[model samples]
Target: MVDVATLEKRPPSTIALLEEMERAYKDLPMEAIVKQDILRQGIHFLPEAFQVIGEYKSKDYFIFSFDHIPLADLKDGADTKAPEEIKIQGGYFDLLKTVISTRNNPHSPYKMKSVEGIPTLFLGDISIGQAEYPPIPSWYKHKTKNGKFPGEIAPVIEWGYLLYLTVFRNCQYFGKDEECAYCDINHNYRQQKGAGRPYTGVKDVEDILEVLSWVDQEDQVAKVYTITGGSVLTSLKKKNEVDFYLQYPEAIEKAFPKRWMGKLVAQAFEKEDCRKFKDAGIEIYHPNYEVWDKQLFEKICPGKASWIGWDTWIRRVVDSAEVFGPDKVIPNFVGGVELSEPWGFKTVKEAIDSTKQGLDFFMNKGIVPRFTAWCPEPYTTLGQQAGPPLVYFCELLRAWKETFEKYNLPTPPGYGEPGPGKAVFSVSAFMDVIGYSGRN
Candidate 1:
């Protein structure tokens, strides 16, 4: 419970801005607007807030350290105390059940505290909603023979709706030369190791199978499992990227064929190479194109642009559709990277317009792209700067929705559900904006 005096209510201007956006984008749900802003700006928890979080699942650092500040910067020891995701409902705006990923920023206006002994989220002083954390899965208590916890082996995210298996923790594209500018994968691995957490660089296939045995036996909610890791530009364990990544799904499907939907998040390989994953029972492929604008893509993802080249990367994304079907070939773009400072577009309109073109291109081809809200993590090259404005995200959501509806694409397979009250894809509001018949 944050001390009442220690928690400052949001300044008047902040609430006004949110209210104004809500009114302006009447067709878009107020919940989506708030969710996007919460993600963009990040959240803070008062020391007392941990009392409520202790019983729920804590942040797993599943992939990237999606925090605005590094673990060393947290004042109230929030790094280890924060929940994986928080669900908000019945706040000042009477928000529906909206799930937002936990991105620790001790200075954020959005604060979580136990107000009057009840867990609540406060947007500057106004109580927005009662807060609830995802339950720690029963399988979480189990560990592998190598003394690795299931969380470090294979963590479940999206509020326990999906299994996240990060087989290779470190990306080969290290430093400014190759690593994506907005990414902190390499830095996060170091921080976790420094924190003395069991951060494995390369998890063994046997460990993964051991974890899944618990998932298969005790878990009932996880329907999809994604096997992803940092890009293996050269070779990992004497295997090429495709061959290395293929082992997990290959093994999983071999052991429990079709027990759960298998998805792969890896580099966009040649069409023929992707067929190997499909044949191994992987149903979805996400060759993430970090950003859309050609200039920005090269600038933000130098290694990817240098190695795959933007044209071939896009081409392979399209090419993979033939192997996985158009609907299954879903590439992800960091939603607000086009609005990043320095090399990015100068204004929200320019950014959205540029991104819209990319969305239109892929949507026209029957391949849909999804995005996670960018957190300006301090360790990355583009670190600690204020991220894109909330307005940019709202406009981006609108553009994404209009373009998606224009194509009449089916609901993306692995993301749990769609629509405002029902959406569980916490990173972005793409899921929330769907079925919004009110789109103007």
Candidate 2:
């Protein structure tokens, strides 16, 4: 176990950690540096900042409760008040409209404060940049016939570039031993319900279609839709995992017929199962290989480790290349988890080398894998541990960029424009580090 006393009692300053990383990897964009740090350390909002977020696109708690603190513990009502993301620009770093997913950490050094009536993000009272909350899209105002909120049903993220459809709210991965050690999906479901939020456990296809119908008619900023949920290890409804998920794409494709790019993040299934998704009009497949190191993979993702062993999971990702086309088969890694305590690497270099091997393995196959920086939520088993160092993320981004360029692969699909300030897949800086020529 990690030294919880160290993580909770008192922690190092986020800015200090970031500055050390910035100096170490000077070549990387400062935007990415701050992005990774914000993801690692999470963000805190002042009461005034919360007042301003009231007018913006609020966080929908799409899948996991990505907050460091739970909903019940948000004394100031930050859970309901926080925006889905904050776009940073015009400050010391001169950041160019960089979008970052909001992971609420009340103790974080990076605090969102108000300045001259405008909300801004500060690092230890030293203002880093002005922050902009995503404007509430017109579609968000619409509601389903059953009176479910549109924001709860189909929320958009990455600066309104992708319509996120978390079809199933709860994962079947059960308790601590079964779920990913760092995941809080099941617990998040209970907390959201306990808080009296209208969170749906299993979203209906018609409700998804209803939301899409509104999005299809009213939204232009949304270019893609991702149908994802926590792992459906067994039958969710009556159907198996693939069958249950495939129905959404089939229904959408039939209704809209390629109106938007379709992506699916699910378990690593056999090629036959993959063909079902491809046939259903899925343009991109993300069978996320959460961690690269085998021993750590087994420890971190016990459910995946037991259900679909690491070797088989990887083989399926490779097998998917034939069905989805190598370029379209993008596997995702949880970028920072390789350095988590106890089971992970003892040093940053080892972690990066292991992750790089996974990257090289896929990129060399003309298959591009992507990653989201890991957030250590308090409810998760791994939450007791401190996340990896900021330098590890900076170096990992550099390693990813180098390997991506070495193979000269096209920018992966589903995510919007790549490069600093333009990329919208905000859970990590992987998208921000890719070549930016605008969307392919």
Candidate 3:
């Protein structure tokens, strides 16, 4: 077991730790290392920081809260003021441009401040880089005929490279026993609703279509649209999980006829169900296996374990590759959850080895597994404790890159280009580290 006291405490300095990591993981880009550290620890925006953020794309509460603290705890209007993602470049590391998603954590060593006139990311006294906020999509300025803003209906993320549509916001996983311990989906819904945000529970096809019309006509940046939401365990809108999610893609493909690459993030399903999505024009399928270890999956994601069973879920993920094409069938694991508090591995080496097993299992078959650096949101079962250390993420980036290159796989479709300064998949450094040729 990890020593809680020892694990929770930071080293003498954040910069020193980062520099040390840079030296150790020579193959990984400095941009990726810094991006992962900011993502793993989350970011704190000083009150003055928002002054520089003039009309940027704000966080849409996309899918999960993805914050270290609750919305109620936000004191500086960060809930509304914070940008959806920040692109950092040129600091102590002389980093290339790297995009990172926003996750609010007031206590994190990384802080966002407006230095002179530019939004800059600072770790201790060191200026990590100049931070650039995502631009407001033109469609964001217009509302649907029914008065819903396009952002609420279909927000663009990954620096506006993809449109995110969470059709069923609440998961059927219900409570502590069922909900993934690291996920804040259900809780985020409640908080978003409680805060009086126009957060939709079950989005209407008409509403989504209207927003897509705006995006199709007004926006040029988005190349992909993802139809995802919480798992429909019993039934949502009186339809089973696969049937419930299938409608959106069907409507999108029919209406736009493949205007943008379509991707679906939903629970694993049989080959028959996977074919329906492939028939509907979805280019990619993400049956998110939240964790790799059987025991960890059961402990961290009890609902998925109980309903689908690990063995069956694994089989479905492999089987669906035939329908979507193995390269297109991408499974996502929550990156650091293998080291999550009580149930996680005792050491980073054990955690890396366990996750790499999952990576190799799929990648060897041409199904690439990607990860979002786990954010320990306050509402989830495992949120109270600290997340995995920064070293864990650095190791994960290296492992992911090594496995990806071993198979000589193509860059996963829909997630823009890869490599430092070019990648737009901002949630983690998996994309950022690709094709990196920095110091060894």
Candidate 4:
């Protein structure tokens, strides 16, 4: 949150940009357009507004920093003070209850400030909505025998609707030549350590079980738990990539079968490797095809391109659908990565057309893809520059929604409910744009 006394004035053109985008993209919800802009640009929270989230759940740095600026650049003590996500309800544009992932940017024109101790979201001077912070879950009070709180071991996102367990904090993709250009996993892990926070690089298996035990007993809102982390290229405690991540689900399912829907977000493994996860009782598989464009995929994700090669990686994605079932094999693609510079499509139409070809290829076979709106976190390589325009995201959503309907696909499972207000997967408005009513 910012120190209001030292807040600097920013250009008012951003508000005008938002209005222009809204007017142009009338088919898409105003909520979707505004949320995309806020995510792309990031937000600066005034101290007065930060006070409104008293004792609420703060960010756990799940995998990436997801901030516009690096942790060192944040002057406002927003590193640990800002709420995990903000839910804003009807105000300036009569916006529905939209849940947005918090990304701190001190210079953003969109600021969160308090008006009479009630959290109010603003675009310049205009009110957008009243912001609501997510309350701390009941399980947060309990601790494991090793003296670790459940919140650190397994943090929940989407307003406490899903449990996120990033078991391997750091990726084996070590440097600029290896790691994905847009990813900040290694850097964020180092920064968290520098900050003196209790960020574990490799969480213990028993610790995960102990924490989830509390979640099992105390939590009811959590319907899904995702077991994920940075890729394991070499070894994690003498276990290969598949063996290392397998322990969590194998143990969880053994203890409580079908307790909560289990999802795995990992590297694109071959059919045989993927079946081990399915056999271990994992319900959904997300082998995220980071981007659809082949040439950009090579330049941006060097390690993945080198190790598996783009063709092999895509085949594995389709092969995984056979083992996990097409509907359950949900491969994720970074929505805006294809539009990144130095090695991306120059036009929005070109970007959409290239991505849609991939989408259609998957959807035709029944494998569905979902995306998280890209955050131009200034720390990462591609993120050093700005992301795609608001128009790109708007059209992306429209294409995604229309294609989903065209294929007559079922809603992707695990993320709570579809449509705005009801949807809790806040990282992107993919869920928000789907089945949106005027209310949400």
Please list the residue runs of candidate 3 whose C-alpha ends up more than 4 Å from where it truly belongs after superposition: 1-13
lDDT of 2 at 418: 81
Candidate 2 residue runs with Cα over 4 Å from true position: 1-11, 14-19, 436-440
Q: What is the C-alpha RMSD of each candidate to the true structure, in Å?
A: 4.8, 4.0, 2.3, 5.1
- Candidate with top TM-score is 3
Summarize candidate 2's per-residue lDDT along 1-440 as a digit string, tens digits.
23222333234655565555556666578788889888888889878887663578888888888888888988576878888999999776678889999999888888999987788999986788999999888877888998988888888888899888989888888787789988888889899999998889888888989989998998899999999998887687899888899999999999999999999988898999899899999999999999988999999999889888999999999999999999999888888888887788877778888999999999999999888889888888787467876667777988998899999999998888888879888899988877643221
Model 4: lDDT of residue 3: 23
Separately for all candidates shown, the number of backbone clashes (residues 3 or more apart, or on different chains) is 7, 0, 0, 0
Candidate 4 C-alpha lDDT tens digits along 62-97: 889999888977766687788899999898778878
Clashing pairs in 1: 1-48, 1-49, 9-124, 9-125, 10-124, 10-125, 91-128
Q: Residue by residue across 315-414, what tens digits does model 3's lDDT show?
A: 9999999999998998899998998889999888899899999999999999999999899899899975777877788778888999999999998887
lDDT per residue (tens digit) for residues 130-160 in model 1 = 9888999999998788999988899988899
TM-score of each: 0.96, 0.94, 0.97, 0.95
- State each model's CA lDDT, in order: 0.88, 0.85, 0.89, 0.84
In lDDT terms, how accurate is model 4?
0.84
Cα lDDT of model 3 overall?
Answer: 0.89
Better of 1 and 2 by lDDT: 1
